[model samples]
Target: MTKRQQLEMDRGQDGSDSVHPLHNVSSDRSLTVYPRGDGQLVVETETLGHLTPRRTHGTDEGRTDAKLPDRPSVHGLSPDLLVPQPATLEPLDQHIRSHTGYPDIIYQATLIPPANFAMVAPFVYRSSFPLKKNFPFLLKLGIKSILTLILEDYPVQNVKFLRENGIRLFQFGVPGNKEPFVDIPQDMIAAALATLLDRRNHPILIHCNKGKHRTGCLVGCLRRLQHWSLTAIFEEYRTFSAPKSRHMDQQFIELFNMAHVGPLIDTNHLPPWPTLL
Candidate 1:
């Protein structure tokens, strides 16, 4: 096998960071993973790969020099969450704050209820594998009981785990075309929420690889559906994200450039990637 392919396989096993030319994200921050008082694991949001500081180092404790950092700082997406789903920006100690009274915006997946969050698209995203490989630390910090998930073309895997644990996995097939003008598949999104109505108070975590395109489009549509002023929603998602524009992943982006790409619920227009531009 190619050395690059071998390295990727290693990442899949250890879930640690490694130096790779194709990889695009390595956290400058540290990360800590621990069993939370609740069944969910508590992970340090600010640090990416470093384990949460502890007097003793073991399975849950952390170490440094990890190749896969949980999150690379990005715009609108909360590094604090580590998992990179949308939620209200409330704590100064965590991510920067933004407020929208709606409360439905923050969520894990559209298939689940947003815990006190209003659905806004600014936190949505989509990017290809080299980036996913770069952010290796993302694999940690979820309940095995909650099930891991996989999407149609989303490079990551784990849907089976999530479904087995009672986390619902929905499929909104992303078109294979690398074109920039991605139609927001409104029907799929609406149908997903219809399923979530039973769990109106539960939280959902929605993500598509980089959490930029597919996730963003869905969040944007959800915000619009809520009659939210897109402008305000953008402001809130930005406060939490670090923002990286442009990437080398796929082709077919010119159409994305033709459209007015505003922040999800809506704020200032962050420029599209060069391919999209």
Candidate 2:
């Protein structure tokens, strides 16, 4: 399977230049192995052939300044070739803080969670766009997949990190709710919900730019699937998107078409959420 699978929705406007972007989408499912457990990535060292020679002391040989004989060769190759090169001279603290390179400093790393991060269920989490610093915290979660709602190309740094870590990306791009475009396409949300219901995507992280409007809408709809009361759902939604909660997002959750989403779910692999109907 490919590293990233992107599904997008097309806004059927008559070629009008609205602030929000629109693209076409299709309903299709992809599968990949979900790797678990914590294992360190092994970094290979370069073989270095150079060896410093030692001279004998307090002997006739020392007066002549002759070098010591080389160690025995293995398979016609010098044993010194088996020795690895020394590490670079960069400082430890600066390397970890700058995120300029991956070094052994991660052994003593500080894991920093993303903004507005919270656990939605046993294996699911929600957060704002993850930064380089947030990667250590994500590693600890053992994230198997990521579901992103931002309507832009994933960052190169993030894509590289995900590729290196064996995490799959399911990108369903959609614009955030803005005035006059309060309608978030139901088909996109329904498709996203179908993906969320499958246990294969567990240990998933749902995110948008700020984890406020778009993320809140998706989580609210999920609460609806779990048979949560609208009152409670709205309360939780407000907690994350407090100062800038959008009424349109709440409306989308209340009126989300469960009938459209139900048929798309694979009942055999549904998550073990008791309240899921």
Candidate 3:
């Protein structure tokens, strides 16, 4: 091909172009292509009905991942049960442990609700006392073990830390910034549960700072997953956190109803929802 032809192909202006990074790109936008020789790249636009989005989305906007290096124990307490802050909700930490910090508790409440599929909880939120310590006690006291979590850029360190100390974690990453949000693949959560040796344990805990928005969304997902009624969820979470984390409860309820279907997510202990409409 001539140099001019090659340039046109690279610009995605020629009909004959095969591997332009942004296929059918607009003139004002250009995409740099680094192929398998570097890193394969492509871009494309989709129509939303008759309206064009006329907007850009992030490439790795709200990505959450595994692992972190263990940090020094905060407060005067040992690295046992801690309440990382930005949490305005009731102090479950005083009941569970003695230490606390604000921005330090990344995704602290990620245990699943009596199911194994929500292991991301411990990983996303690192703490000293494992949720395992609280589960049996909660159950003996007649509270259903339920935890809801939401976090961002959650570390794998939390996951490894919780596991080393005999705790199960559950985290679902929804990528975005601020109130305007987009979802990353939380389906990997179900995959995490499938790998666990046991699936029917209880006294699960889930958290996000303040145990409000993200925690709420997760409880909603779990309620739908286990076929529990919204009323049951509100009550269960209230029982665990005591004074009741109602904002979390309601937020989760909104998210659950958003799906408009009953496909169960906690497939480890609960059978899959029948996909009912």
Model 3, span 1-277: residue lDDT tens: 6655655666565444233323334554443322122112222233442312222223422222111224365454433333222333345644333333434354465433332223323222211222443443333333223233344544566455455556544455443223335442344333322322123434345455554444444444545555577677666555444464545335535454434232433445542233122
Clashes of 3: 33
- Residue 155 of candidate 3: its Cα lDDT? 54
lDDT of each: 0.36, 0.73, 0.39
Best by TM-score: 2
Model 1 quality (TM-score)? 0.31
Model 3: residues with Cα > 4 Å off, grouped in runs? 1-163, 175-198, 224-252, 255-268, 271-277
Estimate candidate 1's alpha-carbon lDDT, on a 0 to 1 scale: 0.36
Per-residue alpha-carbon lDDT of model 1 for 1-277, expressed as tens digits? 7665776786677566543323322345444454332223454434444433322223433432222334454554444343423344345433333322224335323332222223322222222222323222222322111111124543334544344455444555553223376444434554443332223213445555445544444444444444456565454334323273222111112222223322221222322212121
- Candidate 1 residues lying further than 4 Å off, grouped into runs, are 1-157, 176-182, 196-201, 236-277
Candidate 2 lDDT score relative to the true structure: 0.73
Please give the distance, in angstroms, between residue 58's alpha carbon in candidate 1 and its true position after superposition: 47
Better of 2 and 3 by lDDT: 2
Q: Which candidate is the best by lDDT?
A: 2
Candidate 2 pairs with clashing backbones: 9-23, 10-23
